[model samples]
Target: MLDFYTNPMSRGQTVRWMLEEVGADYQERLMNWGPSMKGTDYKKINPMGKVPAIVHEGRVVTECAAICAYLADAFPDAKLAPPPAARHDYYRWLFFAAGPLEQAVTAKSFGWTPTKEQSGVAGFGTYDLVVETMEGLLLSRAYVCGDAFTAADVYFGAQVLWGTRFGSLPSLHAFTDYAERLKGRPAYQKAKARDDALIAEGQAST
Candidate 1:
């Protein structure tokens, strides 16, 4: 069985949704933000002391995007990944969401808006460009790679969903419509319900 280490309030929720998407039978090891996550035990699983790490068949995987890609590939029956010819867009948008998009959201949250000069040096260019680029991509297709929903959608959709919720990304029609379509997925609903319950349980324990 897969051992999933996570904290509901963290990026772990994204991995949880992916697990459900792939129909993986896994055990969840919920870690707390401070003591549980910072301890040596959890640290060994993810040296960064982050949640959303997974140990599957004795192999360890960390990072939300990596986990999503790994799970999709590991379970070929799920057909979450596209053919080699289509992999360019799949990998492209997945990392785009993980890298530039994440950076822009983090910078905005910390009120660290980058100047044009700084954007030139930054990997994401400018925050406006990041948002506009993402919007244009989604505007052109139902999914990142076109009409088909692949593992890339799991990562990109989660980013867009979180960005829209926290007001980091604009509530553009393209973003909102895509996010709504993602939410309609049964796996997403299941993951959300499970994580919501876990969050409530954690709060109660505190």
Candidate 2:
């Protein structure tokens, strides 16, 4: 069985969305910040003492990108990842989001844009370059791997949605339009409602 360890306000929300998308039967173990997440017991699940860790069939998976990819492959019936033979764009965009896209937006969050010389050494080049590149790709296609939605959307789209909402990313038409499409999905709504309720419950208790 799949055992998911996460906090509602964390990146785990994306994994939860993937879980719903796959229609997997999993047990959720909610955790809080500080000692609840950093204690020895939880550390065994993730040495980093982080949320968004999963154990399936006794194999542990951490990191949002890896977890999303693993779930897609583990439940092949979900069709979240394209078949091995047809995954050039799938793999490309997935890792691209995990690496350059993440770095670019994070750097922007801190108000750091690499200069021309510095950009050569920065993994994401520049935030504008990353943003323009992604905007171009979305304009050319419906989803990361093209017309059909995939697990790539869960990870990458979450970044776009969160980034746009929190001002880390510009409210470009491509991003807002794509986020609206993802928000309309039944699985996305179910996962979001669960996390939203969790957040509200924690707030009420505090």
RMSD of each: 0.9, 0.8
Give the CA lDDT, 0 to 100, for residue 195 in model 2.
97
- Per-residue lDDT over 115-196 for candidate 1, one digit per residue giving the tens place of the 0 to 100 score: 9789889998878999999999989999999999999999999999988898989999999999999999999999999999
CA lDDT, every prediction? Answer: 0.93, 0.94
Query: Stretches of candidate 2 above 4 Å error?
Result: none
Model 2 — which ten-residue stretch has the worst lDDT?
105-114
* Tens-digit per-residue lDDT, 1-206, candidate 2: 99999999999999999999999999999998989899999999999999899999999999999999999999999999998999898889889999999999888878887888999999899999999999999999889999999999999999999998998889999999999999999999999999999999999998
In terms of lDDT, the poorest run of 10 residues in model 1 is: 107-116
Query: What is the lDDT for 166 in model 2?
Result: 92
Relative to the true structure, candidate 1 reaches a TM of 0.97
Taking all chains together, each candidate's TM-score versus the true structure is 0.97, 0.98
